[model samples]
Target: MTCDRLVCANCAAPVNEGRCPVCRASRERLQQQEGVLGALTPAALLVLLVALVAVAVLARSFAG
Candidate 1:
């Protein structure tokens, strides 16, 4: 849920534009909340999928 597309109810404008104080504050809060997980791009997801497959293979081999 990024704030880039959020519409501010205070001024009936886009939050990213910061049309009002409430919109700016809400945008800032959303940005801070997404700071951590927001950086997980497609490449990171691909790497994580590969790691999961490798782990699954190892687990199956050990079980057998």
Candidate 2:
């Protein structure tokens, strides 16, 4: 989950704001753990998957 959407239990505030030590730690941890595709939204990821499948099909058709 993104820090902007996360609520900090320690400070009862948004984690992105880093209102307390817990928020800062959690935010840092989340930032470090995000992977290459982590930033992509679900819709964006779905579009990318569809494009990749289309490319593979085109490549196979051209090769055949």
Candidate 3:
């Protein structure tokens, strides 16, 4: 649901590029909604996700 993947109906361009006023506004709104955590790069997010999964697995094993 990132703005990079969003298509602008105003200019038929990606919202992340900010090609039009609408795109820029939309991008800004999305970034704000995401907050500090959403500012992270895709790679960082993936690493965090993997770490969380590993923790979940460990916790499950310990529980059993």
**Model 1 Cα shift for residue 21 (angstroms):** 0.6
Instruction: Please report how far candidate 2 places residue 56 from its true position, in Å.
Output: 0.8
Q: TM-score for each prediction?
A: 0.62, 0.89, 0.59
User: Could you give me the TM-score of model 1 versus the true structure?
Assistant: 0.62
Better of 1 and 3 by TM-score: 1
lDDT of 3 by residue, 1-64 (tens): 5886899999999999999999999998997898788778899999999999999999999999
- Give me the runs in candidate 2 sitting further than 4 Å from their true place: none
Q: Clashes per prediction?
A: 0, 0, 0
lDDT of 1 by residue, 1-64 (tens): 6776889988999999898999989988887887776867878979999999999999999999
lDDT of 2 by residue, 1-64 (tens): 6888889888899999998999999999998888888788999999999999999999999999
lDDT measured at residue 23 in model 3 versus the true structure, 0 to 100: 97
lDDT of 3 at 27: 92
Give, for candidate 3, the lowest lDDT window spanning 10 residues.
31-40
Candidate 3: regions farther than 4 A off: 40-64
